[model samples]
Target chain A: MISVTALTVSRGERLLFRDLSFHVASGEAVALTGANGAGKTSLLRTLAGFIRPDAGTVTFSAADPAEARAGHLHWLGHLDGLKTGRRAREELAFQARWAGADADGIAAAVDVLALEPLLDLEVRKLSAGQRRRLAFARVIAAPRPLWLLDEPFAPLDARWRAALGLMMQAHLDKGGAILAAVHDPLPVAARALDIGAGR
Target chain B: MILFRRELALAWSGGGGPLLACGFFLCLTVLIPLAAGGDPAGLRPIAGGVAWLALALSSILSLERLFERDLEDGALDLIALGPAPLELVVLAKAKAQWLAVGVPLALTAPVAAITLGLPPAQAPLVLLSALVGSLGFALTGALGAALALGSKRGGLLIAVVVLPLFIPPVVFGAGALERATNGLDPAPALAFLAAWVLFAAVVTPFAGAAAIRNAQG
Candidate 1:
């Protein structure tokens, strides 16, 4: 379970969000919604341990939802985080190896993502949508139980969107938790946590 | 090990820069004697300096790519969060850079020396000194690369940050070559180069890793 309590985040002299509290229990899917510049990405980044809040704390608890798991959260941001000048297959393999995923898991991720045909193509040569797919595949391949996805549906087509929704459902069925920031409505029964009013 | 291997593979697959740098080294080594005109003795005396300068130049050519693209794509952040410690990641990256740029230059030094009219016996010492010196170059370059990752003009920024650090290696490497070619013991210069490499190996990774972290943040 991920619990964020009395969180206050600021960039420079401006406060992006304050007094923000939320809990995503095991198997729960929570969508972060806000207008432009409403701190949705900041909230996700803070949850993923990539950003530090100006006040309060974010905790990941197995029981009380007030503890932190230093290594169990996976973050997939908007940039896609791909290494350029490398073939798609090689990049995936490298990421998997670095993440300590076994060979079988790597192969399964490639197959599920339908990345076979583009395996030998360098990442710089791949389309933006394809790069996003590759980044999504990396998240799926990670063994982390908590996922923080920022703009997860950006370049995905309708077919990929449905597939991703089903994938998230499967992940939730396995007792995993998700915190995603999306502009579009997610095709899941997730409680919306709007960050506009800093509630 | 995986990170090191991946870095190596990436450097190997990147085209143009690595090859052109090696070619430049070779061509420069050959051109020195031709330009000096009909004086084999003069060529021999300057072979060590020419070879070291060529190696340094080749290394600079490849340094710009070290962390630039990875930082842009967010791979550097992922690597920092991976299982390996940041220091080890920096070391692995330095090793890859050396393999791509330094190793090739070292391997071809003997051929370059031949063109420069350097004696066969002095060739190995020149190559060995270059290899050691280039390790330091790679480490220092990696730090500069990390520091310049997000700058507006990264290429020029890296060159500005790194050129000063190149002095110690260039001096010792060329000095070692000069001593070797002149039949004098090259131990002191070689020792200095080795010590520089050891010092760089110990300290450069931390600086590079910290720079990467700051850039990511």
Candidate 2:
């Protein structure tokens, strides 16, 4: 299970979220809904160990989030963050290698994302939707137990969104958990945690 | 080792700026002799200095790419999440930069030496000292690269930050070559270069890694 207890996140003297507590057990999908500047991404970053909370702790049962990063959690942020000048295959290979995923795992991910035709193309040249798809494909490439995605569907088209829904379902079915921040309604049945402005 | 190999691959692919810097190094080496009238005696005295300056300039040119792309594309976050400590990641990156830019420059020192009319006996020592000294340059440059990752005019910013740090290597490398030409052993100069490399190998990575984390925060 992934848990955030009594978390208080602040940015430069302003508290974004105070005493925020939450948990997503295995096979659960949790959506973070919030107004503009409601600290959704900050909350996600804190959970992913990318940002330290002003107070409280984020715990991963299997291991400390910092120590077992590859095994325990995966974070897909607002930026598609693809290496701009690299071909899709090279990017996938590099990311998979960094995540400790195997060659077979990478191949399977490419096949699942239907990126065979685009595999040889440079990422910078790909459209935004294609880039998002490629970023989404990384989740499949390295199957971590917990996923924290910021705006996973922002740049995806309807078809890709549906495909991503299925992917999320598959992940949840396999005993993985997801915490995603989204403005649009997700295809999956997810519990919504709303963060309004000044709350 | 795998991380180092990945960095090497990224640099060697030349899609980034390192390849252009190599070309710049080559061009500068050839241009200086032509501009200086090809006076072998005068050129011989300053060959190591000229080469060291060229290496430093080219290195500064390529330093921005060290962490900029990764920071922009989110690879920096992923790397921070890797099992290897961030310090190791910085070291690996510095090593890769050295291999791509420094090692190539060192290997081709003979060409620069010949162009500058350096004595044959001094060429090897100049190359060896440069190889050692460039390791320090790469490490120190990486720290500046990390600090300037998201800054405006990042390339210029790194140069501004790293040029002052280049003094020690420039002095030692040039001094070693000068001593070699005078028929005196340059053991002290070479030892100083080695010491600088060792010191950077230990500490610069921590500074770089801290800078990266701070930038991300």
- Candidate 2 clash pair list: A81-B73
Where in model 1 is the C-alpha error above 4 Å? Answer: A5-8, A12-14, A52-56, A62-71, A83-85, A120-127, B30-44
Interface RMSD of each: 2.3, 1.9
CA-lDDT, candidates in order: 0.80, 0.82
Docking class of 2: medium
* Residue pairs clashing, model 1: none
- What TM-score does model 2 score on chain A? 0.95
Error (Å) of candidate 2 at residue B179 is 1.0
Cα lDDT tens digits, model 1, A1-199, are: 7888999998778788999988899889998999988999888877755666788877777532212333566677877667777788888887766765788877787888898898899898998888888887766786768888888888988998888888888888999988999888886779898999783
DockQ of candidate 2 compared with the true complex: 0.52
